[model samples]
Target: MKIQGKTALVTGASRGIGRAIALELAQQGIRRLLLVARNRQRLAEVAAEIERQGVLVVTLVLDLTQIVGVNIAIARAWRSYGPIDLLVNCAGVAHQAPFLESKLQNLQEEIATNLMGMYTMTRLIGRRMAARREGTIVNVSSLMGKVAAPTMASYSATKFGIVGFTQALRGELAPQNIRVMALLPSLTDTDMARGLQLFRWVLPMTPQQVAKVLVAKLEKNSSEILVGWQSHLAIWCQRFFPSLLEKVLRIVAPLSLSRSKSFGEIANRQQATGNRKGFWRIVLDFGFFRSNIQTFDKGFDQGLKDKFPD
Candidate 1:
């Protein structure tokens, strides 16, 4: 699990958490780094940055949704870097539409990108790792993977699948000396959240912050690490008090919908204005507000713990 001088492959490495993770690994002395994403330019940019740190970086612009392309990309990476010591499956997408209104294509894409892509990449590199009897796999999952939410049914399903996949794979691969870890992050500030307004109230940490925790946990070979306090509480609540949690969610559903509507409107207005600055300003505001909610939720949990003193 040691990162220093290791060869690491990070999918979705063009930006956000993937980019941060790639950089983190490089900083940890992971010399042979493979950065994968659909955008060649961005991938090259990341590669340049990593190379500045004196690490050897390979950029692959391959759409992971394509099964054949993914297999080819894995083969190319292996040829270039030999057996990958660490594989970080970070590529993902989210669709926010009501269940009844959701399109089949959108659902298919989510499953293909979020679930199947990870499966494909893991299987390819995992086999190599097992043969070598050394490696680590980190799947960047979400808190929604552990609990469901309105309008995010499809997204949540994919995340839930990831959770299950990682857990089962961990059990299967332990004997092979290949550690499978799931890094569950709450909402995070990234382009993926750009079109979603309701997420503004969820206030997520920056990708860099989440990446720091991810890398730290990987070093310790932790099986799963929940990112935020609210995330931990959400998992515990769903597990220990499902009835109470359901009632609370039902009461808050209307407010959540209203927030989503408002956010969508704001995003549309910003788009109409064609003001990039204004668009990002709104995003920043939303991120901050969401972070506040996460803080409050965590504080509430702390208060409960103080009262119970278990």
Candidate 2:
């Protein structure tokens, strides 16, 4: 469908890929945008930016994890600005940690925000779209959805769920003329990914590049949009060489875990929590497997370093 002159509701619109998408939509001459996120100030900032492009902007401070609250917010937005032409379910939370080290609270937060929140928003807007018989829904999934990564078990689970959900919704909504699509982007240079320790050769793209690719594909009736060559390659690897991919992941699992631990430590330090021993705690918490995994990771790390010396 044509993006120009369409009213779009974009969740997680305060920053990162969501922010980029909203701006892209504006640049494409979108009539209006309802920006939903927990950060009201940031939403206002984004609104101001979009306003400069002459697109009407509405900010809705919403915490997607709260089902009732999300429902209420959507209802209010709809009442105020009738008939959403497009819906972008992009609000999500991601946390990286080994399953053993992951806090239950953090895991729950990820599920509530990334999965349940999206499901709720999709269902609500989707019903209206179905009734109207014309609308588009874009669910921002991730490359991790196609291939689970170590130290991101919970996050990958949610993203994988999104892929399945989008597929099912597409089938159900197609007859209604309500388009449903999933966008899978590789590691992006967003604030959310700033703390992640990238693999040796993986290149991260900017959010703007991802947004540009996705927006350019909006007119096409594609079921899934892979933002970069990396995402396409990763999915291809999973499809044609599952076992080889598994072996590669296993080789990097220990390094991924260390990166997660390091990121957590950095976060703690930034918050001035002074938890200097957190890294050792992560190491010891895994028990007997820790040493063996570290040894395995060390050999592979050295090999990679030799092959791709910086």
Candidate 3:
């Protein structure tokens, strides 16, 4: 699909990869953008940035967890800004904790935002897109969607759900000339990435890099856009050497557990000291935090980089 002159709606447009994608789309000549996220201030900020690039931007301060309100907001935006030609479901939240230690609320919120939110937006926006018989939807999943990690079981579940959902939509919507794609970005340098405990060999990329890849994916009309070589390699291993990947993950589980504990400790200290940041925000904001093992995993990092040079 031609990105220029299209109106795109991007959720989670306040920060991180979502924000990057919005700007990229604007730069690519997207005529209008409906920016959706909870933070009105941040959304406005992003809107200003996009507007400066000569693209019209409208910010919707709606929480995806509030399904009814989200629907209403989308309706309002449609009424006000006209039909959205492209939809980017990017609003998401995650909580990093071992399965045993994960709180029920955290799990529910993760499902609500990461999985259900995408589903809700797609259901509503997709209907209109299908009616028009021409549109595109991009669902942002993660490398974890393909391969689960320790202490991030629930997050992985939600992301995996997104991948499946996008795949299903691809089949259902293809006949209507509506395209659906999944974007599986690895650890990107963002606030969200900074909060996560990552594996030894994982290297973080900038959100701008992800935004650029998104444009390329749009032009190629690719179904699955894996942002980094690390993601590509991981998925390859999962398909051809599943047992080896599983074994490596098992060996790393204990380290992941320790990282979870450290996160818990930090949360406790923040609470005790009355830090402005919420405990779960700190605990769940594991964007690209290196696993302690990464500090000493020189050969693993070097070998992977040598194989897949930047």
- Summarize candidate 1's per-residue lDDT along 142-236 as a digit string, tens digits: 98888787678899999999999999999999999999998889877678865554543344567888888988788685898899887888778
Where in model 3 is the C-alpha error above 4 Å? 251-310
* lDDT, residue 213, candidate 1: 90
Clashes of each: 4, 0, 10
Q: State TM-scores per candidate.
A: 0.82, 0.83, 0.83
lDDT of each: 0.81, 0.82, 0.81
Local distance difference test, candidate 1: 0.81
The lDDT of model 3 is 0.81
Better of 1 and 3 by lDDT: 3
> lDDT of model 3 at residue 174?
96
lDDT for 245 in candidate 2 is: 60
What lDDT score is found at residue 279 in candidate 3?
A: 30
Give me the candidate number with maximum lDDT.
Answer: 2
